[model samples]
Target: MNERPSRHVIRPSGCPGLLRVVQALDGGICRIKLDGGSIQADQAEAVALVAERFAGGVIEATNRANLQVRGIGPERDALIESLLAAGLGPRNPAGDDVRNLMLSPSAGIDRRMLIDTRPLAEQILTTLQTHERFHELSAKFAVQLDGAEALAMLEHHHDLWLSALVRDGEPWLAFGFAGVPLDEPAGRVPLAQGHALVVAVLELFLDLARPDQNRMRELLAEFSADEFVTLLARRVPLQPCPDWRRVASTDGLHIGIHPQHDDGVFVGAVVPLGRLDAAMLRGAARLAREKGDGSLRFTPWQSLLLPNVRADNAAGVLARLQALGLLVSGDQPLAQLIACTGSSGCAKAMADTKADAHQLAERLHRRGQALNIHLSGCPRSCAAAHIAPATLLAVAPGRYDLYFRDATLPGFGALQAHNLTIEALDHWLDAHPRSPLDA
Candidate 1:
């Protein structure tokens, strides 16, 4: 347990949450964990203001659907206080790291949702923050609560995943460990017991795991999920989810106008390569204040949406989003690419992943290849939570080792190329045009 650096409960983590500003090669990074990726218009504007004033104005929307202000300086504490003042801090000071519950951006309003997950998600988030024991959990430890939303992100794995499903005509949450909702659930619980199940799982993890085993997957590496669930039964009610298949979500639901379960509409837009300038953020905030509900919800796909928009004005909102340089169409190749802060900003980076991704995007656009590509500076793969269809792991200044996603293999799937330039990658991609990676 002393793997923790010091004799303090809230030990400093390398990963920055709202309260912590971690030092990076560029500057201090202050991560703002949004509740289910939703931020009120005023809160968004406050973020814009603080970022511009206290940081270098390089704001990043993380893959997990949160915001981070990069290039922060000596004014880090003031910046943190300003954000906290804006109601962006965790429920408890010690609970900041443990508040890693993720929900679908379209949780309540998605057309295909079987249950409204926001209420349950809110309860879980509150418990994760307010519960003192969970404060010791890793900041990266995360949970996914899915409502069978058509706009859900199924690829990004989580420590624990709970997906809505029907059992004998009643709503139940089919849950799993260290995987996505698409994976077979280890068990199920009634909608009412959802929070208790999460609490039990987290408590069991804390009880059974050493400090090094900060994640559910790490604990699972030594203990089986069956064992964990069996132990969990002693603490909370557990029911086997015999017949549950998480419904497949639509791919393009993260962009353009989408009809909600109700008569309202939602306008979605991609943030070109997951990076947004001050104006882009402020503009989105203004739009959120004006057209739709006065709130914006970011998605794991590195995009955002204005949910509960009036059906009549959805088209106009989409056009305005496009005019502001957000990608309103999913067909755009650049929209599919994700690149981490490369050599330009990160000391660990070899090649510039962001710049390389741009070049790769141009090549793919020319070849009419539609693929989900992730460019990582190092093995950390900071930009992508899951192994993308294609990955360019940087090995040198301008060279990278390419890998294609293979489910059977671990860690970036099957290695394709040793070290290739962007030009060489284009050739390889051109050769394998119809590969499933490109589909």
Candidate 2:
């Protein structure tokens, strides 16, 4: 195991990293960023072990496809060291916080992928970590590389987004700034120049953005996209792509058996409320070793996928995942519900959102309704990246204000009701089965 480095070497940030454990209402939070959302089985076991030994055994699969161990005690160094030994730490300690890149969980394996994005993703990730200039980026500054996978998370916005495209029978990447792949792209680059395009964009952002402008959107607010693209053209070759728009990804593929590009299949299951116990993770790792490839991939939807399982063993894998306490079917109400760490773990939270979500899930299940609902403890809406069809924002313990997503509105969208109890909210939802809120 590598020796623990001095505390000064770690960056000062409110966010948690492997080398920097930030204090929380529950305990310390140490986030382990995975490469392209992939982790080997042995590394996962190491996470489970240290979580059980040094923390409360409460592990979270974050919305960004990373794992964080919560409720950690003072043995923070030991936990971090163990994870580093398992190969979870960044290439250098200084690079940890800047390593924010999102790729489709099925990057290489997705059957509908236009190109395998793993290789380019690796190149981009390494540059993000090792390039000292890139380290100046805010911890939240992120990039997304999409292989045009059918299982992609296309809704989450990023500082920069690149999606695979084919023109004239040759693969190219269509990229945009401060938006999702679904947005119209700024330009296209040859597949071989994808890495250069990413580098050029980041360097230009650093050169142009003010100290206060930590995100691309913030910078773009001051400078127009067209103007920025015009400037970017001087750094790298750019091609017009006015006609390109990313296709929307299919949903529910993250919670069931799905075929990969090869003959094998991948099984996916949701971690309940985005929280998992050590046993659950260990069990999943064991399944990955026995029935699938010796690796697991996490998705932005807070789910885990075990890829390369034999087609015949897919059913057994799903059954075992269900036994491990993961929601295996999208129809399960818990699978559709997401909740943030509420009063139990976040000082900013007004109520125990996780507990309330469980109650809400049971009520929805009893009504045979599996609606996409987000239970946020506060306005930050940390539980969801995209607005859900329905949302319940906590106002007090056991009380919430309901909102239905409206493209015409902002925040959690139009608030439909205020300060209703869980039971009352349940009845309200049932009463509006035919409403657009239920769509």
lDDT of 2 by residue, 183-215 (tens): 989999999999999999999999999989999
Candidate 1 CA-lDDT value: 0.86
- Model 1 alpha-carbon drift over 4 Å, by segment: 1-10
Any runs in candidate 2 off by more than 4 Å, and if so which?
A: 1-8
The TM-score leader among the candidates is: 2
Worst 10 residues of 1 by lDDT: 1-10
Clash tally for model 2: 0
How far off is residue 46 in model 2, in Å?
0.3
Best by lDDT: 2
